[model samples]
Target: MGALTIKNVCKSYGPTDVLKGVNIDIQAGEFLILVGPSGCGKSTLLNMIAGLDGITSGEIQIDGRVVNNLPPKDRDIAMVFQSYALYPNMDIRRNISFGLEIRKVPKSEQDRIVNEVSSMLQIDQLLDRKPSQLSGGQRQRVAMGRALARKPALYLFDEPLSNLDAKLRVDMRTEIKMLHQRLKTTIVYVTHDQIEAMTLADKIAVMKGGIVQQFGSPRQLYDEPANMFVAGFMGSPSMNFIPCKVVSMGNETGVEIDGGAGTFKLPVRSNQLKSSEGQEVMLGIRPEKVTHKIESHLENSDFHLAKCRVSINEPTGPDTNIFIHMNGAKVVCRSTPDSAKDPGEEMEMMFDLSKMVFFDPKTEERLA
Candidate 1:
């Protein structure tokens, strides 16, 4: 059975519409992630799912039963918020077992569950210590442990790792992945971090302006983005967008790029280009897809070679980023650190057009 379903769910606060017809269907044991910039209604959708917020319209079903009117406690869901709300005076053991205690679990069973959870989270020795003594990461673990202790029908996490340091966040991310693998629990996580969304989610929902923009696996979002916003939002350094005019070159479609050496035509392999001819379009390509000319030929691929004077070069250990002018716009090319030339030097570079993406400049929609 599908674990959860949200059908045309919408939310409004008086005149402001917070969510606009959100829909999702997740299978059992799937790790679903809702990610977007702040105020995009990712949290609002999660709150509604957990019954922390009421839905304005539409139906929500948990295991085939409509749950729009169900209270949070009756929804069989547990949420871990951004803030680790650990009890200040209580020790870690008590904090983790507090929910079970309130449910009138026996003393022996509570102790057994607490010990098992602490061991799983690797906080066995710190059970006796109070929340004040634990580090940010440790405290986050305790908060997670509290939820894990219950084994609820669904786990809802709202930026649970956003409070920790960079290094610790990375560690906790891996640990959470391991935990999910072992437990096989159905989870719906919310975050604004693209890397977290990419690495942790079995499926991802990208939201913007209170609406779902795209929903798919990480590789699908990266390689075949639904629109220009998703194409620009999913990767680091972002995909480069250069404005050019679409033109016909024999049987194939091409783009005219005027990069100082004079205007040149570049072939584009898209059947959707018939209507785009003579129209302004945005050429989207990742920095890594733009590499040194030598490397392109070495890989047995023909490169669309262009010559331009380098404006800047940023060497970061493994690779060097060379910035230059292309079609009157600044473009970045990724090359080996050892092969970097100085700024102002004219160098030949290749655009791996095989991975190139085209967008309608006016609509901001992907053309191919």
Candidate 2:
């Protein structure tokens, strides 16, 4: 049996519908991520599962038992929010064991559990101090410690690292991943951060406008997106979509791209060109797939090579980000820092067409 099952769950407030027939089945010990932009209902769905908000329709089952009508306190779940939410007056030890105290757990047992959790989170020294005496990262760990103390069947995390600084956020992300590995407890995390979702989730559900856009592993979503929204949303620099036309070159059918230097035809074996020939289509390429000619590790036959002027160059430590124009659309290339030329200089580039994606211009659905 699945750990948690949400069957056709829907939520609405007054005239506004926040969730539209959302459905998901999470396996026991799976790290599930709900990721999307604001007002996309990721948090609202998490809240419904936590029983902090009511479900307008459908049922939620935990361990094969209906939990839709249960109160938050009755659910065997722990939640950690963006804000640490540690008690102001209570020391870390008290805050960590507060939930146990309310449930009438024995005093000696609570102390043992708090010590184990605090030690695991590496915050044992801070256990004697109040929240005001701890750093932001330490406090965040304490918040996690509080949740970890319960050893609950389910954990719901709502943007837990959003409040921390960038550097701290990175550190905490690793810590959370390690903690999950050690505990092997089921977790449903909500975040808009693509890196977090990609790194931590066993299964990712991308939401948009109160609907699920796609649900799959990170590689599946990147390689075969359901639509343009998902293709553009999952990557760092985002996928570049270039408008092109399918034209016939002698007896062969191919896609034409205006590379500024000249019009080049790229063969399309995956997308049947019978009906699409002489029609407009979209070409989607990721930044990493674009590269400088000299720095390209692939052989000449591996990718489609072209020459274009560098419109911009952004060096980000490990790799240089180069921008160029193709068919009136801006394209980004990830190249070695040493091989990047100055802006306005003409440079040879290779577009790795093997990994390239084709889409229907009208529907924005993948054609290849």
Candidate 3:
């Protein structure tokens, strides 16, 4: 089994702590991503798992075996770094087989492993080329090939795609996903890109200020974020936050939003809203949730139409982002390109309140 468990992990340099009581567990073959902005201690935590850095406190287990004090070489793990740490002078074949050579693996076995890895990574034709002769993407594949040759219990990738261009990065992401499916090896990957985390991870741990803010399946974090920070950070356009006062309209609880054209009351039913009557709260809604009116949604009791003056319209191929002022804050609404209006034009927009989320204005925590 390739399962991994980290318990109460902490890291410190002198008096300053880098990781503070972080914990995570993953079953064999699970793809876990450590994602956050720079200096969030994701790489630091990854290093500790790989035995590259000494842990200040906590236990790391691999397949139920404690590896806290073990050295990297003894941990039965392989790492791929962002810099593509390939030997400049060594040919691809030598680079892929070097680890096996040191492990005293038989020459015949080493040759077989090299051939298999090179073929798996689709780099067999470039085996004779040196690191300098390969492109950025090619070199990355070679790096992965070297790790695959080891057949380790765990694979650690530290922002491995950060060095490649946008197109190559996307292409490589697909390749890596396919590799994980075929190998079924436990992987702990660190990346600051939220898109990568959403696309590649079976589970994601979002970190900030050396603490994990949230950890779950990507859809869980996207659909039900722990707080405003997570809701805003995980999406491309980011969820829109509008500060409004909660009020009661008939038997339904709702919030009032004042667009430039008129005031609209959107009925909402959430635990937070029940107790927050007449109190100010942040209403959270994703851009796609706020769109042009659809006939089917008109029958929903929580659906309402409002008129707003478009402040800006940005066409993004398949859809257009319409910016409008609501509750004195700029809010983005995604609409079909054909239905989008020009700037300063008054347009009718639909607000779907069924999926709206509420957060405490002071604590910034999800209230529902």
TM-score of each: 0.95, 0.94, 0.97
Clashing residue pairs in candidate 1 are none
Clashes of 2: 0
Model 3 misses residue 47 by how many Å? 0.7
- Encode model 1's per-residue lDDT on 41-147: one tens digit a residue: 99999999999999999999887778999998888888898998899999999998998998789999999999999999999999999999988998999999999
| Residue 246 of model 3, lDDT score | 91
**Model 3 segments more than 4 A misplaced:** none
Model 3, 122-150: lDDT tens digits are 99999999999999999999999999999
Worst 10 residues of 3 by lDDT: 267-276
Model 2: colliding residue pairs: none
By lDDT, who's the top model here?
3
lDDT score, candidate 3, position 335: 96
lDDT of 3 at 214: 94
lDDT-based ranking: 3, 1, 2
Q: What CA RMSD would you report for each candidate? A: 1.7, 2.0, 1.3
Residue 4's lDDT within candidate 2 is 85
Candidate 2 lDDT score at position 192: 97
Rank ordering of all candidates by TM-score, starting from the highest: 3, 1, 2
Candidate 2, lDDT over the whole model: 0.88
Deviation in Å, model 3, residue 365 alpha carbon: 1.1
